[model samples]
Target chain A: MPKVLMKGNEAIGEAAIRAGCLNYFAYPITPQSEVAEYLVRRMPEVGGVFLQGESEVAVGYMLFGAAGAGARVFTTSSSPGISLMSEAISYIAGAQCPAVFVNIVRGGPGLGGILPSQGDYFQATKGIGHGDCRMLVMAPASVQEAVEMVMKAFPLAEKYRNPVMVLGDGLIGQMMEPVEFPDHLKSEPTNKDAWSTNGMDHRNSKKRNIVKSLFLDPALLNDNNLQLKAKYDQMRSDEVMFEAYNTDSEYKGLVVSFGTMSRVCRTAIDLMKADGIEIAMIRPKTLFPFPEKAVADASKKPTCTHIISVEMNMGQMVEDVDLSVKGHLPVSWYGKCGGEIPTPEEIIDVVKSRIA
Target chain B: MQSEVMFAGFGGQGILVMGKILAHAAMEEKYEVAWVPSYGPEMRGGTAYCTVVIADHPIGSPIIKNPKHLVAMNGPSLEKFAPTVKKGGVIFINRSLISFGANRDDVDELAVKIMEIAKDLGSVKAANIVALSAFVARSGIVSMEALKHCIKEEFSNKPKLIPLNMEAVVAGEKAGKK
Candidate 1:
């Protein structure tokens, strides 16, 4: 493996390119703009289309156009821009289109701030748009993980016939680390023509394919919702992913965090452990199918009495932690909104206080 | 405990590179490390600072509002970050540019005329490396082997510049002998 220093945003772009995504559509936003800038030059080199869409709205539609034609497509944006694309995201899910979306999140209630934050956790996991739809949300804590997830997302999205999002924060988007491109990774063009709306040649004209979500009948809509719900149920079993550290030992409480926040939590746990505090962390890699079992299991022990959720948001994921623990254990939250990241010492202090 | 350092100067002054080299060294020394560069408009002809965190274990938060070690290559950087240095922590300043010395009594200040030494050695670009070398030698925060290990790793890709930077490191180490 050849190691090259790369920014998280640029790694996402390179991974998409390697994953055979020939088309990219996005609008500029803080932190994530580097991925777009990287693709601007890189996509052309690889015989791909890189479009700086007129707006996030146009970019979403363009992604729909590309995915409809059976092309591997990708687009990335931050919080507010993602809000604009939520409508198209719903449409893609309704159409059962396979594509990748990267949300390098920033703080936001409404144009909240430019700093990195997990405020969009609920939006990404709960299906931000109207209507019945679900997306595969992968949270990457480092640039290396970001690259690997983007590569893995293609197959995962195709398998589920849904959009897979690599959700992260601005800091993770901008931070630099050595990344190694997977050896022997090759991009094989996927022929999704069976489901795509691209016009078939005369030789294949006898068979027609149309991609639409217009179920005029109410019963059909209900049936579609049921089918979507079933897919989500299956995903809960198939997609939940997490990492446990120092969990084998007797621990006091479990720390729940994701993305860049998890990296910080790991450091905090190490520090507290060295200082004689026996804390552990359950880092969720899949934000949607949130390894709820792991969290619940951690709460089963009487000594592990607290579940602390740390994030860049005010408190988006704490709700999920609460739901997972089901009031069996008290769930607490310590976080900063906007772009501010909580240091390990601060988190250690918070965890110690909670344990006490 | 987490150790934070800020290396700041104008763009093209090698401030960021030096910070990265130090971070890489810490990592090689088996310490957890994080290197965050200044982004946005501040990087264009203005003061640029990169924060580096090195810890015995994993690092948390990566954002240090009060860095323990400061390598201010210019006046503004020293002025901006001086007061935040922890008491007894070292502040290594480039005496050629930052004439206004640090005022904090709690922090230990090392005034190195790194630019003058680099000029004697033939270029201003070496000043950042020299200051880093001086800090490493005097502060003993990182071992010489670790610094050399980091230098080798950082220069492994840019093979052409290794000799000059190594010489600068030598010059810095020699100069820091107090």
Candidate 2:
């Protein structure tokens, strides 16, 4: 198929449709509103359901209801909006529902600027909701990667019977790039009959399928918590994804980044390489099941002396890098918040200052 | 090879669309391309700009600090971006709006009366197309033919505008080639 130019937001919406997710519930938010807008027009054309809920809170539950009923459902929002959806997200995770959520993050502590920022990294990968619930968060670095991740999110969500998040900063949501949806990523909708809320008559079974997160009994709730923990452990071992660049040779410093910030690191690496400075990068594709081992191994390399985590936020992902490095090498941090993206030259300067 | 171009002007001057068309044409030519616009508050009654990166290989970053080519459609845009063009880069100015020339001596600067040409061609709305044609002709970033095809496709829904846009392209190309 010929590639077409598409913004990251619209491409994700189309990719979800191609992935066979017919139900979409969302509220309009900057940088990500295009996803909802695109779906509003395209979903009905494909005989799917598209609804604009009153708020992010409503959309979260709408997704919960639709997913509980065994439909492939998804929603998109920005930083503040995601905060509004947190309680419902916690419930969905506690209930072990299969749904996809996309966060085209914007800057924030509270009502942050509308520009792109990875400030939601901590919110997303850590403490997204209350209780012991974890989401399989995938961060895409490019528009094409965003498309592929969105298409893969559905199956991944169902496979774990858990929520999956496609995390992208505002740049990924707003930029236009040429993309082609790969046919291999397309899959038939998963069989939801096993756990869906379809009537007993629809399933033709004697047992009832009940979907709820309320477990009042202490022992029973503990059991549910243990089950969720086990799933997260399995994901930690099996679902970790990352990409390493220029790590083969000796390096004076290693940079850890994710999403759009990784591309800036790539350019910085190239510039430093041209000046005879050896620098490598590790980009984590999955933020939750972070590429801890990769970062640890890269940090242990004989020539690697220091590590730095560059992000769009003040220092969210550096904590993860610090955990991965674990005293083998020092992990430094550099970032600009409030939607200000650091340029390649700026990153190069940071590397110089750190490694010098 | 890679060409990093920035198009800048007032909000309603179609600066973003110019970059989009260039990006679309680059995609048509099978080049890896990215178009990033200055969105949000700056887009409402303020300066509007977008960067288009066209490269044979994948683009590393869409946000460029020093573009190799700049299409400045107004005085403020020209004043702000002319110094940021890479050394030995090209700056295409809309002579109809911007009175001053580029201050840098190392770069190649070309000035075209884009708005005047578009006005004479019967639609001042086509000024962006004129400036885009001038940039492509001057920089040879994308072929004139590919650009024309992209313009026609961009206005495919409103077919009547294609002829006027094409005329603007030819007139601007003539001035740019000179």
In the range A51-127, model 2's lDDT, one tens digit per residue, is: 99999999999989988888889999999999999888888888888999999999898888889999999889988
What overall lDDT, based on C-alpha atoms, would model 2 receive against the true structure? 0.90
Q: How many Å off is the CA of B25 in candidate 2?
A: 1.1
Q: Where in model 1 is the C-alpha error above 4 Å?
A: A184-186, A189-193, A199-207, B1-4, B10-12, B24-32, B40-46, B54-60, B65-68, B79-90, B100-109, B118-126, B136-174
Candidate 2 residue pairs in backbone clash: none
Evaluated on CA atoms against the true complex, candidate 1 attains a DockQ of 0.40
- How close to the true structure is residue A17 of candidate 2, measured as C-alpha lDDT? 92
lDDT of 1 by residue, A96-199 (tens): 77878999888888887777889889899896677878788999888788999999888787777678898988878877766777743445325465567777
Q: Could you tell me which residue pairs clash in candidate 1?
A: A115-A339
DockQ of 2: 0.82
Give all TM-scores, in the order shown: 0.88, 0.98
Best by TM-score: 2
